[model samples]
Target: MKQMEDVITIEEKNHIDELTGLHNLTGILEHLRGHDKYSASEDTVIIYINVMNFKVFNQKYGFAGGNDFLRGMAHELKNIFPDELVARTGGDQFIVLGKSIDKEELLDKLDDFREAVHNYEKGLKMKIKAGIYRAKGTEEDPVIMVDRAKMACDDIIRVYDRDNNLYTEELDKRNELRQYVIDNFESAFKQRYFQVYYQKEIRAVTRKVCGYEALARWLDPTYGIISPAVFIEVLESVHLIHRLDIYMIDQVCSDLRDDIDSGYAVEPISVNLSRLDFELCDIMSEIDKCRAKYDIPKKLLHIEVTESAIASGADFLGKHIKKFRDAGYEVWMDDFGAGYSSFNNLKDYDFDVIKIDMGFLREFETNQKSRIILASIVNMAKELGIHTLAEGVETEEQYEFLLNIGCEKMQGYLFGKPKPVSEFVRSVDCSFENNEEFDFSSYYDDIGTVNFLNSTPLETKSMEIMIKLPIAIAELHGDQVSFVYANEAYIDFLKTIGAENLDRANEIGRSKERDNASGFANILKMAESSYNQRSEADLVANGYVINTKVRFLSRHGEKAAFALVSRNVTAQKEAHSADDYSAVLMHLLNLYNRIDLFNEEGTFENLFLCGNQKALSDIERKAVVAVQMYSDTHIMEADKERFKKFFDITTVHDRIESSGKHYLVDYYRSALPGDEDRILMYIILPFHYNGKWRFIAGCRYMDELDKLKSVLKQIEST
Candidate 1:
């Protein structure tokens, strides 16, 4: 009898985790099964707890320290929930089964567990995330219940600040998105939904397109173009991100090859390689294959090694980076100043260019401390003989700040957004190839004055003239000098001074045949009678002096007409007219060709007026137009409500205000009107105008906003 008792005790010992001295996986499963057999209460719940970044802890503290940490966690769990069945399910993961415990009670216990783990030991600190699933007697399988708990845990992991998550039907629905990605991963490659897009790095002072950064995009038939932010990590977790990286580089090579074939200038493009690529395959060989296959010039390809990637596999990354440099590829340290290992990695690695993380700009806009750090980084990089590339720039303020700090290369919405191969090719040719090299002798040198005046509509001709210069024009019909047409610049000026539908007002004034005509019409008739055939005047209005030129001529089979040209000269009044506001505005509008308005009421709208439409950009003008249509007519009430919530003006204002000076708010309009969707918009800091605050918003549909958001989340999590 004694021997048999000892044998039973030994058997029980086999069911326990050796390191934590808790119930093992088999033991916990059997225990739950036994409870089910005995008709356990429906209130029983399984709580799954996972240690965040356990691998990092293991790497830092070694296997023995990790085991100690797990042991301490198990001890804390046993003490906290004395009556519950606790088990060490796997490395840095534990399971707790309790009867008659509600969600709040489970959450409280998990919070205690998290706190205890954080204080466990000097080298054993960890953040634990818990997922809870209440059992429904024998209706649900114990294994499946545990899985549901794990799924909830996974969801909570995304929200770094939270430690506990309750399993719900909604979480299961989210799982569908994940499963869809996994199911369609292979097809995404085969169908060529994965595409290569490029965002050029431009010289800060010259505003010249100098280099291109290759980015990946997925065009899913069902979901449209899925953001890499949504799928990249999933692929990395499933060990498939390396394949995507290779595919992205290959696509970029193909595009470059096409550019060369089509006689477009082939600028060097930097391809980002996942850290897993180095771990899984021969990265150097893969790159060589791409260059050989495309017959790409050695200098035409650049290698961008991310700071985090370097931290993870320093030896491999350092070796490969040097090899890339040796092979004639310009190697860049991407996302500089983004992580804890930033300076350390910089000290260890050799790079041709240091791509300053856009987060600094976001931070600089919000935190005064970030500006000092940014300036320091720029100065240091220059001292080290490394060219600095500032990414995520969106506003004139940021562009000017970076240029002032001597940042060599600038890449962001301010310059241009990333574009697909077909569109990007045109953008590259237009921006960089308009001349032998970028001409910065004059900001408007590339913006040739519109001279193609032909059989075009008056409105079209007016727009062509307005966009190319600071001058506004009004075409008048008859001796009344009635407004038959008005350019956008003039319309904008009228709108600025509480004027609405000046064209309609002018048209009404033009109708002298009407019983009730505007007084302005009679005034225009008197002016026409008094003035010579051509007149010039310095008409001052609203703090701006307009150099007005009027000429009477008959053209395009029209009667004698008055052509009024008004050039704003407000910048001439300022001390620094060299940095003329109109010239600055033109440069900005030229760099990125989209206009957005954020009103005092916090209502933001896309105007879709920018540089020439011939200048290819990533901004989804179709989406902007669709949203504008909806805004105009209120077609989708639900969408309007959703947008109202997303674009909560008060919240945005508060956040921006907290930044002290101002920062760029990077976001995306993912669901748009047409099949092609997801436009990136950058909202600049607001300025107090009239009685309210208004913002000059811009768009860069490159998906870089998604990348920035992901980077910020990672920074917050760590």
Candidate 2:
């Protein structure tokens, strides 16, 4: 009998198979709900696994045997899938929601789960195979995720029915092998026993060096250089990915620092980040620490995270991407088009650069559709604020195709192979031959150093910056759209959105009173709004269909003088709206309020408040500092003590108020000796309104009571 405590609500309870305590359809439904929580700038991974021959197993072996087999498989999965959504999507099929677990971990767990199922001898003689596929992301529904995972799982299970790596009963041996790798990994890394190689990207025109991609090389001193394909699989099995990633980053960083400081131009180096690292620790902070230790700028360091890694049915990667970008480093998504939800990933993940896969480029020029796809990729990337770099660009045709489509930056064999630090420096620094015999060193005198640091005739660097700025377009009354001063990025954004592109139009604001559909609606709306009374207002226009942000900057708080800044977050905005916790909270607030039933008036008062005068003073000081971060002021530590000395213990830390309001204000201060100009700079308001955090922090600076009044009035007006 199910106990009273165990009888949970259907939604709250784990969707159980009832006969086996395994995942039911509810798991998939719930996993879909989680997809909405991720940031608008991230993709969610859904691996659908379909159970094979389940009906036959039940018919041949009977319900008891089938149930027993299910229980055994569920037990095996319980440990491996603690954080994942383990849903039995179909009769025997399962869909695992890979929260932030890497693909490698998922593979190993699936293999283990398969093995455990095969070992169920008490149940029946049966084979369990599954296919796994990820979501294509045309839709963000969890059902799509389940469908994809099921497909992918089905593919693997169909051919390798049983007695194979995909499905086996050798659980003990797998565990043993995993443990051995764990034991040896540390020693292998210590010995620097790894194979590190590099692939080069060449310039189709000059035949000069562009850049090289650093590939890891693991050489087992005892057994010879370990293959990355083999060792990486081993690392994944032991769950030591976080450590391995950190090791690679540290090594690359140290190597780059040594080479660059010694006067080598190793423009930038990229290291791959894994799911294990993100959950285990903040990789950005680690990078920050590394940069500080080596005296490196954050911008020089770049890290690559897989699309699948960031799109794991949660906003985990999106937030981390923002954090990394904020810390001043470029973030790139590796293997862009390999995944089905690649387009969704592109929109949601804020990648600084997109490295075009070489496979697409190899035969694109000959195929019309492939060429079109290549062109579209370039255009889309440009529109979305990302620079495009062609990867595996070995052929000159590929390089030419990229350049023709405005994809200038590239990395592959066309440039040069990745070499040791000493070798890379020599390769780029030395002279090279260009078309028909023009040496690169001699050409540099004609093409390089254009008065960058205040020289006379070559030209100014500032002008070069201006050239890159988008050409602005002015939106005036009907049939008068004209060109204005904007940048390339802005121009591309406008073009992508199908905003009418005008050539040779004037670049000035308020030219004949704005009259376009967008401008007219905005201006009229502003006229009808409260912001008309003030000088400025924030306008958040949600273009739901496009999933973009159109922000128009006006004069002051009012859309007066300056123009608007528009951005397309279509992939995220369209999909992200439903995931907003604040929006959800806003909807449920009234119901929650009815349930909580808090009183309007506060219960505490002066003297009875927690902590003594000294404690209150410390809190007040912190509040003052909290507000001071914004205030253009500095209260020296010595000055604080010096001021404290002026008041007696009681006078120094007594509470004050605006008068006649219970639970309204926190501790305040009166004029101190010899410092009458300084008034209380902080207040800890006990009574808070609405749902805002109470115990409010504040600041006040006044000379005299009347002066304070006048100053407050000025603040109120502002």
Candidate 3:
């Protein structure tokens, strides 16, 4: 009896996880190998639990924390399935073997596990995804069942929203296709089966071609045109996507060289880089090599990185993006607003252009929320000095809506679908004449900075406020001024000036009588002067005094673009004297050294600066960078680290939610010379403005000792 017990103990010791005290993979396999118990039972089911983003959690909380988390998960699984055989297979995965369980019951168990995971620790967030696979008694091998369960788990694409999936015959077919892709990828590459297609991006206001995004299409001999959704994901899983990215870069560069040599009009072509590209090789060096080999200008080649790629490996990818930018390549963030971390990505990374995710436009006409979100994204991008481009714009109404919201660029089937380079070149050349004198660089710069919407509250009340402020953006060709965009208020103002709409306003600008009018000529002079200087003018048209401000936006050879803001000052001039207006302006200008306004979500909405302090004046438009700059320049060394922690925008929502406070205040010592004895107080106050929560943040000198103590007491109480 003692010898038999020792054998049983040794067997159990060899097949149990040391950390979780649960059956290991070997133990689970051994149990399934027992023919007497499981071989004849057709009710057996296998559940595979994969903790998504576990690696990121490990990186954040250390291996010891990861072990604790695994152990906790093991405990929860045991409690959830007390009668089943639970096993901690490896890493962040677990397997469970049960009998006679239906699909609905299994899914209910998964939901319970997910809820338990959320409550495991306070302030801890993690995703628990599971896959279910039912086994036939005739299948004796356990490995196949386990793998099928894993495959189902891997098929759950949207990790955040989806919890579990069940394996089916369809998954088996997908598995076969994935395997085929893996086998044929290398041969296909060598045989040049991959082709590069160009999709044109159009300037929203002028409907002219601005650039192209290079997309890859697989022309497999057996399958014909393989869907990128299949091949790209397979390649990424196998860590071979870097090779495809490099191939596309080379192909695009070669195409650009051919187009230039052929005397065809060319624009910047953007190529996407996968997250694996950054992990697998020196991608930047490869891009530089391709550019140099083709002798293509760096500006002609743009780099696009998806938001998921950045979210996966930000620090590593950020360094590579800086290298690309330092080498004069414009980097764009593709598929914006596709994930939960969209705002965080905008705050952390410096992207030249943000490509609004096409999913937002899929239900644009049917969903009011989608329209509001899309407009908010464009407005926020414009405020941050980042260019905005909408993807998947296929309808005239969609195009007009995007144009009205200040989206500078558009790419979709409406302009043209992705086509081969040769075909694209022929189509474009036949459709539009090349402007030999058009300065592409200057034009791109101008359209990139132009924003139609002003910094108003981003809410339902925004439309009301926008209607009250008349704004228009115009394109200037010598004396011919054409209005590209005009809001309802601007159209109303035009009607008051004897013009009905944008078309009529443009026609009046081209008429001989209007050309000789002093008001029209004065407006033109202000626009021309705005190229070198900020200029404003007041003119009487149709018996109303209109105050207009003009700012130069861009120049393309003899053509120019300018943004104009007009307000009828008839009532204001009659109510207040010029001296009162000047006094009001002077008082507002002296309010603060610098003031920044952001939404409750921590997106930078607007900024106002008083003095010409170079350091503060040069801060970037991103909130993350703005806080870092302030900490580096103003806060003392000892307080700098804490100051950063206090000002972290990512934590703002959480802090507000937890504390139920609309404002926060803190004090720190100044780091400037001769200011060692001075203390500065920074306050973040939230107020309801235009139907949204807007935060006004500013720092001021805390001169009075009693006031400083009182503020400190208030902060401590909060």
Candidate number that wins on TM-score, 2 or 3: 3
lDDT, model 1, position 673: 48
What ordering of candidates by TM-score runs from best to worst? 3, 1, 2
- Runs of candidate 2 with Cα error greater than 4 angstroms are 1-183, 195-212, 362-367, 422-718
Error of 3 at 552 (Å): 2.3
Q: Write the per-residue lDDT of candidate 1 for residues 614-636, one digit (tens) a residue.
A: 21123333433334543333224
Query: What would the per-residue lDDT of candidate 2 be over residues 533-562, giving only the tens digit for each residue?
Result: 212223222222222222222222221222
Worst 10 residues of 1 by lDDT: 445-454
Candidate models: Cα lDDT each: 0.64, 0.49, 0.76
- Evaluated at residue 637, the lDDT of candidate 1 is 43
Please give each candidate's TM-score. Answer: 0.55, 0.40, 0.75
Give the best candidate by lDDT.
Answer: 3
Colliding residue pairs in candidate 3: none
Q: Please, what are the lDDT tens digits per residue for candidate 3 over residues 1-718? A: 2322322443567787899988888877877776534332678899998887787778878899888888888888888887777888899999988888878888888888888877554355777788888887667577888888889888985555777888999889878888989999989999999999888888876787778899999998888898888889999998999999999999999988986786557777889999899889999899989989999988888899998888887788888888888878899999998876899988988989999999999999899999889878887787687888899999999998998787888999998899986574464542346322124655655655655555332211233213466777777776567887887778887776667898877765665324224354457557667546346777654445668777667766777777777776754574457668667856774555667776656556446665432334344656677778877777899999889887775565467547655467789998877778888777775443332445667766777546768999999999
lDDT ranking, best first: 3, 1, 2
Instruction: Give the clash count for each candidate.
Output: 1, 61, 0
